[model samples]
Target chain A: MRNIEVCFSPELIHLHELQGKIVVVVDIFRATSTMIAALANGIEEISTFSDLEECREMKDQGYLIAGERNGQTVEGFDLGNSPVAFLKKDYSGQKLAMTTTNGTLAISKSSAADEILIGAFPNLSATITYLQKQKKDVLIHCAGWKGRFNLEDSLYAGALVKSLESSHEADEDGALAMKSLFEKEGHQMKAYLSKASHAKRLQNHGIEADIDFCLTLDLYELVGKVENEKVRAI
Target chain B: MRNIEVCFSPELIHLHELQGKIVVVVDIFRATSTMIAALANGIEEISTFSDLEECREMKDQGYLIAGERNGQTVEGFDLGNSPVAFLKKDYSGQKLAMTTTNGTLAISKSSAADEILIGAFPNLSATITYLQKQKKDVLIHCAGWKGRFNLEDSLYAGALVKSLESSHEADEDGALAMKSLFEKEGHQMKAYLSKASHAKRLQNHGIEADIDFCLTLDLYELVGKVENEKVRAI
Candidate 1:
């Protein structure tokens, strides 16, 4: 059986071996969810930048620039880190350049993995199906809030690990604990995550709608794959 | 209200500001549990070393040396990382020099904290009472296996967080998640921890009794406090 583990935050990613594993980078609050929405809704490709200015400069390259810092849209960026914003319009063949506080940094750090997949609740089933078919060691990397553990991303990891358990044995305590967490709290996700610091942060920003949308499961049968630093639906 | 946060692994400790917080270092599989047991059973002053040789060298200075690596006792050590061994006899007035794969490294890395307290299920209530009385921000540092997240230490952290919740608001998702975990699994700890990687490792080493002992709650009301690298019951 393939092994599955969870790196609770990008800060803890160094303890993991990424060379031969399928890394599912999850930022459940917005970044990965928005990427999934963007790709599924007709954005051709998504390139993530860790720096706000670098992401802003992408507009000159005809890329739609999306950036967020501390849960707010960066000033002067074309778009913010919201899945609903991506779903509002079809970009058709346009590409996106995005950055966020945690998501983009996690993607940048996971460059060593054999394959990087964006994971969020919207594309949950598709991710599970793809990983079940891939049959490789899996590392679910939660893009936790600023290198600290977060509830939503880890719940998604737990959900994914629970779904993949038939074929993949959890190899670390993080995975096991998360799997149990999902089992205990998966039924009332929105209510459960309402206590989450990130959720409360977003609520304070008056984006409760985005939080509800991001937590919605299996909205699209889309799998966002990272290739050469750009994520496109596969 | 005082805030409670959990650093899931020692590797992620740098992301946390330790200066003003009470750092509760926990290695529930054995290390901290053994320290609590030793202190409760009449051992005086435990000094921890991260290096096996350094801990072994303490024997020349009349310290009862204990060492563990990957859940097994070092060949030349006076004792392994088992709380049961400490309870077998009273080494009254004797000092202990100990090293373990995860616990010692966690203590060594947590030197910047205003106060370092050893936490385990055995001293769960004492640690909570002390933190409640101190009225300071608390950081529960789990000495995970080899700088990775582990189940047992995190569960103990959750128990502490849950007990302190009336006076402490959880400041991070790790604290929130673990509090929930302990609430869900605390009643069935032995059966729950059987699925943990380190527990399986210790079971493989024929130390199932230590696992049971470590999971025992409130066996002692001793709070092991670190001052200048020496831990004494206070």
Candidate 2:
């Protein structure tokens, strides 16, 4: 099997290098979380865009324009990048066209990868289990805070490395390092994230309710893929 | 004081944005650690050169040529970026010209800051105390691995943010994010660090001893500074 590794941040490493690999794009701060929640809540299909203008155009075409700009819900859009919003029963069976600050950028950038799937801490275990059986080279691309490194994303990357330890190879220095972190803290999911940036960001803002919801693992078995300009849950 | 809001790696926040602030260059995967060690060992002064050739030219003038190339001691150099090696007795009163992969690059880039001081996890508390006395914006420029995000460096940034918490202005998103990390596992320094990329690199190479030594807080009072052509401890 081709060895799998992770590039913690998409900006730090290019998607071109990930060609032929099954790339998992992760943005834990609401983007991937929202996608998972929507899919789990029975959203039929979702299209993703990196550019807000494109998403707006899609919105004009009657698609549900759902996304976040600067961490808040967009004024004119049907939805924002909150997992809780996506979890609403009304979102079930509707199509979603979304863009987000970091997550969508990472997903758009991973176009060169053989197959791209949305990754989040909540669905980490299931993602790993699914990928391992396919015998493919995996790249965990952390959609860090707008192309810069953020701890929460890297933590999830480390968590993934830990979960896939038996089947993957962390070929680079950073990847190897993240793997060690996974080995050190994979079992203590809540404890591992208790001190993370996003956790506290949510806490300090009095949005503490989202923290527990974001950390829930294996909440979705559906794998979201980037195909035809949108992330479709399959 | 100008508020120094730093966004950690994989996040796209620029180091230049921290200009006119007291930018503390941090790189624990040896440069900053070696700086503290070099000063503790009585190296009178250090000069940093962004270019390896400049360091080489300084080396010929009876300076103790110290640097690491690809994480190992360069040919004919007196040091190899290891803090333990820097503690040897022979380094006393020596003027050394140093170079390294990521750390020095940041030192070079940060020349425009109001004031620049070197920082590392090893000197966490002392650096904070020193920064607290000054009334300038503080930016912790993590010496990311080869212009990219590395977990260990971000962790150091987090450590600094954690220490200066009472200084609330410095404790914003970047600071708060990192502080939360320290809040969770800061006291368990070694265990907390065992999760980083640098530690694992050393561990994989069987050079785990330095990782332990590099985690010691306030082991030295010396501060590394950018001077003449190099960043040396004074």
Candidate 3:
């Protein structure tokens, strides 16, 4: 039977061990959400970078830049970290060079995985369907707040575990715990997330709409997979 | 307001910042349980060490030695990682020098805190009472499975957070997520932990009773506090 595990934060990841596993990086509120939104809105692909300067350098190469630090838009960037910012944007053939505090860093660190997929509430069902079809061991990599576990990401991981529980066995305590949280509180994602630090941080920045948008389930039918340093629809 | 945060694993701890905070190190499977049991059984104090050699050396200095690695008792140790082993044993006025795979390591790493308290289900109410009286910020440091997040510790942390929720606020995502898990599964700890990897590991070793003992709430009325490298009742 395929097993499911959760890496609560990117810092706990052992890259070499992920070599043959399927990894789903969840960065709710809002990196993964933004990525899903950008993809659903017709952005062709997104190249993720850990450094803002690296993403900035891509601007000259026809990549639109989206960078954020501490929940604020990075200086001189085309977009902030809010998913709502990506709504209705037309980029059918354009590439996005994006950097965020946690999500991008997680993607960059998960290069050893056989396949890396972006996961968020907006494309949750699609992501689950994609994983269920793969039939490989799944590792939900939560892009926690700066190397610490965060509620929003874990909640998304819990939701994923809940979806996969019937067919997959939780491989560790982290996975079991996450699934339990989802079972208890998955019905009220937005209300539960309102108590999260990141949600409050974003709320302070007047992005409540983005929070609501990101928490919406199945907004997109596409799966975002990291390939050649870019996240593209698969 | 008193703020509660949980370091889901020892690896996520930022030692320098933990200074001046009230930190509770939890290793529910055995170490903290053992410590609480030893104290309740009249052991004078427990000196915790991350290095096995340090614990072994203390044996020569008249300290009762206990050591565990990978869930197994180390060779030449006086006791294994079983709290039941310490139960009912008369260790009056004798000090214990101990090392464990996760618990002792977490305690050693949290020495920078203003006050370091050992937490386990056995001493749950006592620890909670102590924390409530202290009326300071709390950080539940879970001794995860070798620097990785684990379920049992997080569940214990969640229980702590839940008990203190009326007066304390969860300061971060990890704490809130843990509390959520605790709220969901706290009532069925033994049944829930039976599914945990560590519990299975211990059961495989024919120590199922230890799992039961560790899950027993409020078995001891002592709060084990770390001071000068020793954990003693306060």
Candidate 4:
């Protein structure tokens, strides 16, 4: 049994440490979820570029380009970070290249990992089972709300830890804190997260519908894996 | 029945929001605990500053200037953030002007609070009692380790929340999570907290001695509060 160690923020992680490890990148806010949705709907593959200019080049290459800046779809991109918006597309056999403010950055940084996959609540169970089978020491990277720790990401990390059972080892206080959060609160995420500052901000921005949609679980059948800087659906 | 809020990060607060309320600024690492020790040992008053340059200037003004960077004493100051250091000088009828990376920023930002107070585990009960008597909304600002969530601050917030009993309402999920943490794990803060990420970091930095000092309970008789951009013992 390989050790399963989860990191709550990307800032705290040293990329060299995760080398040759099976890493799962979780940005539950909307990016990972949107990516999963885009792939699940049969988008050929997603070229996740950290550079907006590269994403634009891919868009110009006749691909369905989806990108988000500050949680909204970039002015010219075909979609935004909202998981719901991607579901509106007919991605059958089409390739998608996307960029996001936080999630893509996290995925890009984990390029040295042995394997990198996307995770969200919708695919949480599947992700866990697969990781357990791979049985490599797993590190769950929480894309914190802009270099700051947020309850939503930590809570999700906690839930993953809880579901993984004895395979998990919390080497840091954040891991223990999330474990405590899960042990006490036990995963009523939507209700618990409704009051989050970001959720509140998003609600105030008229994306209230997306918040509800984002909270829904098991909506996508896509499992995204990072291959050569792009997450292609397996 | 005053409102009690939990600030998970220092970024969420501005100086203006704390005006005229009993704001509890917590830096469980060592600063707040040192304040509790100095005041409890019959120190007259305490002044908090965010700038080390200002602290240097205060030394020339005949005030004791003590602080730390990277958990060690500043090269020229009278003392560092260690509670052990504060116990050396009898502060009766004297003033302390201090600066630190985390706690001092919390003090500066909360200068507008009707009364801003330092909260640490050593004086946990007394701090809660003082806030209870004041009978107004209490905001627990955790001076997270370098501007992010730390277990010690959240635990103290949980301790205060658990102390409020029927008199307080759970204001937000951060508080609720804290309350839950306190309920389940408050009884063993040291065993749990001494193992915290920051605590371990301190231990690695050779300041593990300070950790033991910070976790002590009810060790001080003085309450430290802030006014005019300074923390003065009241």
* Top DockQ model: 1
Q: Candidate 4 residues B49-144, lDDT tens each?
A: 778898789877778888887767799888887787767666777777877778878777776677778898877777777877876778889887
Interface RMSD for model 2 amounts to 5.9
Write candidate 3's Cα lDDT for A160-181 as tens digits: 9889877778857888988898
lDDT of 1 by residue, A36-125 (tens): 999988998999888788889999999999977766788888888888988787889999998876888899889999999999998899
How much of the true contact map at the interface does candidate 2 reproduce, as a fraction? 0.18
> Considering only N, C-alpha and C atoms within 3 Å, which residue pairs clash in candidate 3?
none
DockQ of 3: 0.67
Worst 10 contiguous positions by lDDT, candidate 4 chain A: A7-16
lDDT of 3 by residue, B1-234 (tens): 888888977887872268668999998877888888899888898987778998899989998898877667889988877789887568889989888768877888887888999998888999899898886889999988778887788889998999998878985777888888888898888888878766788788877788888888887788899888888987
Across the candidates, what are chain A's individual TM-scores? 0.96, 0.88, 0.94, 0.90
Which of 3 and 4 is ahead in DockQ? 3
**Backbone clash count, each prediction separately:** 0, 16, 0, 8
How many backbone clashes can be found in candidate 4?
8
Whole-model lDDT values for every prediction: 0.88, 0.70, 0.84, 0.73
Models sorted by DockQ, best on top: 1, 3, 4, 2
Quality class of the docking in candidate 2, CAPRI style = incorrect
The weakest ten consecutive residues by lDDT in model 2 chain A span: A176-185
Model 1 chain B worst lDDT run, 10 consecutive residues? B193-202
Report lDDT (Cα) of residue B31, candidate 1. 84
Candidate 1: which stretches are off by over 4 Å?
A70-72, B69-76
